[model samples]
Target chain A: MEIYELTVHELLEKLDKKEITKEEILASYQNRINEKEKDVQAFVTITEQEAKEEIKQKANNPSKLAGIPIGIKDNICTKGVKTTCASKMLENFVAPYDATVMEKINEAGMVSFGKLNMDEFAMGGSTEHSYFKKTKNPWNLNKVPGGSSGGSAAAVAAGMVPWALGSDTGGSIRQPASFCGIVGLKPTYGLVSRFGLVAFASSLDQIGTLTKDVKDSALLLNVIAGHDEKDSTSADREKEDYTKALKNDVKGLKIGVPKEYFGDGINTEVKEAIEKVIEKYRQLGATVEECSLDVADYALATYYIIACAEASSNLGRFDGIRYGYRTKNYENLKDIYRNSRSEGFGAEVKRRIILGTYVLSSGYYDAYYKKAQQVRTLVKNEYAKNFAKYDVILTPTASNVAFDIGSKINDPLEMYLADLCTVPVNIAGLPGISVPCGLNSEGMPIGFQLIGKPFAESTILNAAYTYEQNTDFRKNKPEFKN
Target chain B: MQVSKEEILHIAKLANLNLKEEEVDTYMGHLEEILNFANIVNKAPIDGLEETIGVNEAYNVFRKDEIIESLNRDELLQNAPEAQEGMFKIPKVIN
Candidate 1:
């Protein structure tokens, strides 16, 4: 049997039935990586030997994901492993400790196959910002997979791994998952610990999972979620088995469809596909209601400002005097810091840092930065109010399917617009998931998003899984099977 | 809709970036478009409502202040680009 075609549950069943050993599964994936990695380029670093050893040890564990191979985004720190965030700034830097989520993953007995590629420091919507190499979409080799979490999404879509852990800030996880035709979930802000996940925008950042199906996403979330002493933002709440809520019943569930989402700029094909998905949900004992978000158009703008502001502060520690890249020849202290940052950071990162700094500067603080925060309250409140009436909000994961690589590199604002629908969820601190709905005329995958109330991920997963079961879109696999 | 080169340089210095002259025009164009688009936020009706900086409304996230041992010299210096005599060494600041 093709190992990549099996769901996480099916693979576990095979192992329980003595059909395969952890070593055999690891070997099969390693062989697949060797055969397909040259074309896919989904991973930044592959820890083949480490993966085999981990799986062998985990073979004795009782966890469901004990022997499953999962990919991790480069931004999440793994102790003694290089976590570069696909940027040149930390190319040689090795983390001294694993992020809280990574620690939990290890405890759960999941084998991390490798660190996947991503946009440099999760800045751009397209993976082209990566200083290492561009990650091609598994579906269409010439097209992009999606940004920030593009590599994680593409790897799962390409069958390189059954699941991957990705950080979502401003729709990074959901948008890429939509493009790659997989299920990606961005849990509520404090649902997952971010202690060791390299901070992008601390307030908006969340660790989520990308899987071939919704069940795997829920299972992975169940394993890596909960409060940790390391992260102050982690909520002190009880953990629930998210898988228990995936019965695919949406009776009397209120689904909101924002009017602004269906407006201009959305491709006709994507709109049609989403409409069909909505129709299916309606047919399956649910109600779809048309709602309006007053600040929908401003989501990208507010997201950029607030995210960059937080990033500028979070990245301040990476000076030459501290950890990360440093210039070899520096005459003075100022030169060391300046030259190190100039030589270390990429163009996109530098651009945002400059923008963030300017906005937070004394003169512009009141005009731009503070104003954005004040408005952010409105956006969050809007979601809070809407959640009172609806169980979830449904929208297209992206305005369009994956575009060709480098298409929006020159147009940064246009690229930022790609996360328009997904950013609002981040701003509101709500959980959102993207599930593959259909393929456009170009045969590229299109994802539909489900936004749920705070910590209401199970509702969203159940809805998406129910719709997925009713649809035939996920049956076709990419032609590049190893 | 256009941002001046002087403004760009000013923001850059504040943001701790040493940008090349050629990059200013690119940032200028992008920032202008973004700020113009951001005007939409001004129209949002959020006058009396309290501003939300974080999600879930769980507040009072203060930690108890207490003395804790700092990182050892070696561990601290491990992250430095250049350290000497158990401290970070840098070039002279004053002329």
Candidate 2:
């Protein structure tokens, strides 16, 4: 069997059984990276030495995912590695410390594949905003693999790695996974430690996993999901075995179909694909009910305001005088900041920074920023009410299949709407997953999302797994090969 | 349509970012549109509801306030692009 074709569980078992040496697994991944990376453009940097050393150490004692290669989103800080959030501002910047999640990944003995490309400062929905390069969808080189977490999603989709980690603040992980035709999980806010993630929108940002299948995603979540002292927002709860919840049956699961999620904006092909999945669920003894998350209609408006505001504040630390990139032709302090930021940030990053600052401005705070926060409470309450009644909420992961890279770049608002279905979960701090439901007329994968109650990731995983087992969607891998 | 070039400059300063003269006009246009759409959030009936800021509403992360040793000056300056004698090097501030 091809070593790289092995899933997380299979790779771990092989490592434990000594069927494949750590060096051999590393060589196989490197070979795949060498052959497929230029076409996929999934990674910003590939860490050959670090991965080799990690695997060597793990070869001594095996762990859950020991010796498995995983791609990391560029936004998460890895000690001594360049953690550029796909921005020129931090182009040469190296983090001095490992994020709390990175520390956990190290302890679990997984090999790092390197930093994957993302939207600059995690601002846009399409990966085109990345300063370095746009990551292509593995399904078709011309189309995009969702934004921000595009690289992570594409890497897994193209079979470069068995699994990868991506951060989701307003659907960065799920939307990409949808476009790439893989499984992505955005855990309940604070489910995974955010101590090391470069803050895009503080309250909305949460680390998640993107994998070839739901089982790998669950296994990845088990290793990375937990509380950390470094992140004050990290939930202080006992960790549970997420992998154990994978095999549960979804018979009689109450799935809610939010009326707003199925409305006019969704692509016709995508809608049909999701409806077919709903019918399948209904046939499997699960009850599907049409419900309304009333506040969801205003999700994009509320999300952008709050996210930009928080992003503006969180990104304040990247002054040129510090560790990151600084302008060379600056004469004074003000010039330094002005020129550094002006030259460093890409269009999308600058757009968000301006929007964020506008919302937080003195006179307009009440009308824009504060009201968005107030509306956020309403969105949260709406989810709470729905979750009390239904076991899970189902919707299309994105409004459409992956479009061409340049198709939405000229229209930022149009690009922002692409995340409509996934953003509400971020605002409400709920756990959501995107699994391959079906393919559209163009043959691109369309994902259906499952949102669960806070900390109810197991329910979402179980529901998705049951749907996956019944459908032939998993058999449809992108034609891209090594 | 509520945004203006002067307001854009002010907000940029607050964010410690500098915008180009040509770019400010474009940014002003886009920011205005987004803020106009954000106005819809004001109509949300959140009356009598407490504003939720953080998830789970946990706050006041007060530790025992124990003293931690600082890294040596050399170590601290290791990552700094420019430094001089335990101080970050910079152009003269007062112009």
Candidate 3:
């Protein structure tokens, strides 16, 4: 196999045996990007020159992932890299210092070679909302690799990068990973530090890993997860080595399948794919049962209210005063703030900012924002109840396989429905991983998510790891060409 | 719940976004639909439930007030659209 096609574990094994050099590994991926980037368009900046220089400097570093390349989602701050969140407002914004996650990855000797694209401000489910470019699904060019982490997922699926960092707010990372036939793991809310992540919704936003398989997800998570004084919401727990969770045994493990997920909008093919996995788990001595999670009905609504309200408040800082785009036609301070934002943000982002503003507006707070917070408590309580009976809960990552790029973009409400399956986890602040389950009739990939209790990333990772070992799904990698 | 043009413009003003003449109606429609959908949270039986701002429940996360070297001053202004000798220059506010 080509070096670019190898997983993080495989490449590390080869490097330890002295069978491959870091230069060869870099050259192989560089070649892949050259051949496939035009079709994939998964990056805002391909840091090839920087990666070449870092390979020599980081040589013989002690970390297990030394000299490996990883793509960073555009929203994560990387010092000196243009960390545009696919929005024109910050098109020229260069992060002055590394985010906490970036600092750890740098310390681990991983080369961040690209800034993956996403929805403008990480607000949309499809990357078409990006002000820069739309990343096409490597599985089929006409279809969108789900977003707002489409570029990260596409880059990994197309083999442009071995694994990439993605941020999930309302299903961004997992949806894209599922659509592109890759593994994406959103660590529990506080598990990973969020100091440098461009805040969308402070409560729900998390930095996660998008990789080819479950072990790669585990490896990347091990590097980025930890507490930090920089992020107030960071979990102050003991450090964990997530790779130790890759046990191939699920005997006596209790799994819950929430029936609400398979209701009306879920595609029959996607449901069948998850059912087959449930049967496989049952055969493997795991107990599987249908569970009720009626709170699923209000999750999407609650998610939007809390997410948008926080986003509106968080985004208020960008007013063409300190940094970011400025309007040339401004006559006064208000004009500069108004016109710069109006022109800089895309339509979807504008819609969200407005939605958020209204939700938090004077007369509507009790009806929307405050009520959503109360419902959020209920969502958490429901998950806590289910987690008590089940070690992990299973659901389809996305209701349907990736649709055509423009198919759902025109209708905002329809676009929000794409996140129906994955948004509940973010609402409850739990760890959820999407691993490829099977392919649909149209040949697009279907993903099944395994969700674990808060700070219990190991439980879901182990369950996913077990399922991957028994199924040939990991072998079904997407092949992309110019 | 049909949204009025005044209400849309009111929120837009609050958000500090200047809407184009043609885009206002479109945004108003989309915002209303989303808000109506989000209105479902009102029906939730949340009277007995306490608010969950975040899952960690760790409020007042305080650290020592010791000073450490901060980020470079020059690097922070590198991306500013308009920068002066030591600060970001913006449109005049004072009359």
Candidate 4:
């Protein structure tokens, strides 16, 4: 196998045995990135030279996961790197400091492969909304890679990088990972510091890992997850080496299959893939059974309300003064604010901002925003009740396989359906991981998500790892166009 | 449930965004659909539930009131669209 095709854990093992050097690993990925990046279009910026220099500088580092190549979503701040969040507003904005995750990655000796693309401000489900370019699914040239973390999923799936960091607001990480046939883990909210992540929805946004396998997700989590005083909401807890949770045992573990997630709108093929996954868990001595999670019905609506509200508030800072794009035709301050925002933000972003404003407006605030917050409480309480019985809940990562690009972008409601199966976890502040289960009839990858209790990333990762060890799906890789 | 062009423009005004003539219709149609979809929240059985402003458990996080080295002003100002004397220069607000 080419060095770039190996999982992060596999590469680390190779690095340990002197079979490959860090410089050699970086060179391999750079070569693969050169070959596949055009078709994948997974990156907003590619830092091959910077990565090569870093490998040389950190050759003697003692961290276990050091020397692995990883990419960052454009939203995550890296010192002097362009962190655009794939919006024209921040097209030229360079972060002067590193995000806490970037600091952790650097301190752990991982090489930075530069930034990936996303929806404008992470306001859409498809990466097509990116101001730069739409990332294609590595599995199929004509299909979307999914978003707003499409670039992260596509790059890792294409093996351009061993793994990459992605932030999820409403299924941004898991949906793309499912579409691209890779592992994506969105840790519990506040488990990872969001100090420098360009905030989309502060309450729901979380930094996660996209990798070729489950162990890499755990390994990357070990580096990125933990408390940061910079992020006041960051979880204050003891750091656990997530790699130690990689046991291939799910015996007696309880896995709840939310039947609500399978019914209505989910494709038959995706449903069967998840069923087979459940059966696999059952056969491995795990107690698996169907259960009702009625919260599934309202998650998307609640998500849009809360996410857009938070987005409108969080995005108010970009007024063309401090940084980002400025309107050349502005004479007064009001002119600058309106024109800069209008020109800098894309259509989806504008729609969200308007919707947010409408919801939080004087007459409608109690009905829309307040109602959604109350429903958010219900959603969290429902998930809490479920977790009280089940060790982890299982669901299809997305309702369907990756659809063709441009199919749903024009229809906003149809586009929102892309996140139906995955948004509930974020609504409840739970850790969820999407792992490749099997292929659909069209040869597209289908994934199942394991949702765990808050601060219980180890549980979900262990369950996903157990499932991965038993399934041959992990052996598959998408064929990049020659 | 019904939004007119005046309402959308009003919302755009509140959001500090300017919509082009055509984008107004596009956003209006999409916003109505999204709001209709989001109206489902009003029907949810949350009668007795308390609102959750945020999921993170941390509240009123206080930090030590001590001086710490901060990001360089020159470096930060380098990103400003208009900067003068290490400050973000804007169109005069107080006329």
- For DockQ, the strongest prediction is 4
> TM-score for the second chain in candidate 4?
0.89
Q: What residue pairs clash in candidate 3, if any at all?
A: none
Q: Give per-residue CA lDDT, model 4, range A446-470, as digits (tens).
A: 9899999988888889999998998
**How far out, in Å, is residue A24 in model 4?**
1.5
lDDT of 3 by residue, B1-95 (tens): 78899999999999999888889989988888888888899898898888888888757989999999988888888878888998988767787
lDDT score, candidate 3, position A335: 89
**Model 3, stretches more than 4 Å misplaced?**
none
User: Candidate 2 vs candidate 4: which has greater lDDT?
Assistant: 4
Choose the strongest candidate by lDDT: 3
lDDT of 1 by residue, A1-482 (tens): 68777778778888889997777777778888887788879999888779887776776788767778889999999876788899888887777778889888888888888899999999988899999999998888888889899999988888888889999999999999998888999999999999888989999999999988988888899998898867888888998999899997887889989889998979999999999988898999899989988777766778888899899888887777767888886787777777788888899998788778867878778777776787888888778788888998999999999999888998887888888899989998889999998888778899999999888888998998889888887776776422
TM-score of 4: 0.98
lDDT of 2 by residue, A1-482 (tens): 68876777777778679797767777888998888888999999899777887777787655656677888999999877899999898888777778888888888877788999999988877788999998999888899888879999999888887789999999999999999999999999988889879888889999999988888888889888988777888888988988788764788899999999878899999999989999999988899999988876577799998898898888777778867788897878888878878788888888898888888888888887777878888898898898888999999999999998798887787787777899989998999999998787777899999999999998899899888888889878787532
lDDT tens digits by residue: candidate 2, B18-73: 77888898888888777676677877888877677766785766556788875466
Write down the TM-score of model 2's second chain.
0.75
Residue A26, model 1: Cα distance from true site in angstroms: 0.7
Model 4 ranges with Cα > 4 A deviation: none
Fnat of candidate 1, please? 0.63
After TM-score superposition, the amount by which residue A283's alpha carbon in candidate 4 deviates from its true location, in angstroms, is 0.5
Task: For model 4, state the Cα shift of residue A134 in Å.
Answer: 1.3
Residue-by-residue lDDT tens digits, candidate 3, A1-482: 88988999999999889999888999999999999999989999999889999989998798878889999999999998898999999999998989999999999999988899999999988899999999999989999999999999999999999999999988999999999999999999999999999999999999999999889988889889888999888988998889998899999999999999999999999999999999999999999999988887699999988888999999999988888888888788888989998888889888888999998999999888889989999999899899899999999999999989899888999999778888989999999999999889878899999999989999999999999999998888675422
